[model samples]
Target: MFSSLFKRDDTFYTLLEASAAEARNCAILLKDVMTHMGADTSSQLDAIHQSRRKHKRLTQEVTERLCKTFITPLDREDIEHLSSALHKIPKTVEKIAERLALCPVQYANDIVSRQINLLDLGTVEVVNMVGALRKKAGMEHIQDMQDRLQHIEGDGDKMLMDLLRQLYNGKADPIEVLILKDLYELLERAIDRCRDAGNVVFQVVLKYS
Candidate 1:
């Protein structure tokens, strides 16, 4: 009976780990979507959509399990918050992909790709921070991760401004300009989601630590 009780105690940690892994997978999918932005095939977009569906299902399953189980590895609220935040990562990625699919923008430059890469890096850091939650790392390391995410968000903001300026000032066609502008906005929102994820991790650390 004691061993069975111990296993139940570990279930919440396993759920958290799964959520973190899903976030990382979403990040990779978003990177691929950005990389293939100008490609002739829509395979990447399809793949991201599928991944988002899987993430949604996993999050729901974990949430249901959270409600059914009496014992959890951490606060019930923390598990719920973390699960919701992690699930949003892929949803944002899916939204970006959907926008890209509909937008007629043909990017002549690599600005979107560069911004997405930065966001992916920031996301990886956030995932690391979330994983550290299971181990209950020092407050200092969690703060550092939050700081890095903030810096990344700043970079994304700067890049978005520069891209907008170039789009309006350059001799590109009006329709092309509009398309690129919307695409940049979507990419910016994706980065914002990454920062939001980092914030969620920070809250978890602050609450439990």
Candidate 2:
């Protein structure tokens, strides 16, 4: 236990921060796609894919570093768990982009935009939480961020229900309904992925608190 003090490595924190930034970048790309519906989104989609690749590479780096290093600032399993959780955010965001690009609908409504906004907010909080790890931030602060994530997730669920209700009301064509529902659920899942990462952060803080 005494050696832990002098053996601390800050590289994990750097990798985690880079991963979180990628997640935020992915969210920003998704928001851009939503705001500029009907415009050429290939560039944005490519950007998301790039962010996803960067994040995946970061996650692998974290794992490889963990294997090589004898001591880590945090628990090995915790670092691995958090890295995996952070990777999911970009992966899900990429899926959302693919779904949107393939969607026949040329425009999005308030619901879609609102969902993307919530996702953006959630990713911002995630970036904050990951940064906090560098300082060994307090449990209360981490919990506060987790609460915000939970609220965003709740809002996402409600918004999805409202959207489905509109789709089920029977005015829209069946094909449109199918596409919209899939896209909506994908967006919600992306938000949920953020919530999952927050939960891992909360648990890590709780353990070391």
Candidate 3:
């Protein structure tokens, strides 16, 4: 019975790892989209769309497997909630990518790049937290990560508001202002989703620990 339980635990961890990989890929795709601001966005959007689809499929598989298995590594509800939150990461990224494709703007300003970098860092930290989920007692690091994510997200919000105000007040072309507004909003949304991911991880750690 002990051996059987260990096998079940390994299977659950494997599923969680797969989900984390998908989330990481989504983050990378978002970074690529920001890096190639003026380049052809068609390919980047396609890549993000594909990643989102794959994440959805993997999430479904994990859920179905959890339902069928007699033993689970964590509480059944925790498994369900974790899987749902993991699925949202990619979906949220895809939404931003789609909006970006619609509003094509070449950002000469560095604010976009900085915001994307912060978002990527937050995603990386959250991914690390997800990996440590199996060890409930090792979740002390999650609180630190959550705090960092919140801080970065707050910074992003402030930067976005400042830039928006400058754009509205400055002598930039109206069309340019519109494009930057949309882009800034999308970038802020991405950062917000990363915070949401952190919150979900925090809940998981709290419930289990």
Model 3 shows how many backbone clashes? 0
Arranged by lDDT with the best first, the candidates are: 2, 3, 1
Report every candidate's CA lDDT: 0.76, 0.88, 0.77
lDDT of 1 by residue, 93-202 (tens): 77767776665545535676787788688778767877888788989999998899899999999999988888788687898888788878877887887788788779
TM-score of each: 0.85, 0.93, 0.83
Q: In candidate 3, what residue range of length 10 has the lowest lDDT sum? A: 1-10
lDDT tens string, model 2, 60-150?
9999888777778899999999999999999999998887777655547777878989999999989999899888899888888989999
The alpha-carbon lDDT assigned to residue 25 of candidate 3 equals: 89
Runs of candidate 2 exceeding 4 Å displacement: 1-6, 105-107
Which candidate do you rate higher for lDDT, 2 or 3? Answer: 2
Clashing residue pairs in candidate 2 are: none
Question: Weakest 10 consecutive residues, lDDT, candidate 2?
Answer: 1-10
Return the lDDT, model 1, position 184.
Answer: 86
- In order of listing, the candidates' clash counts read 0, 0, 0
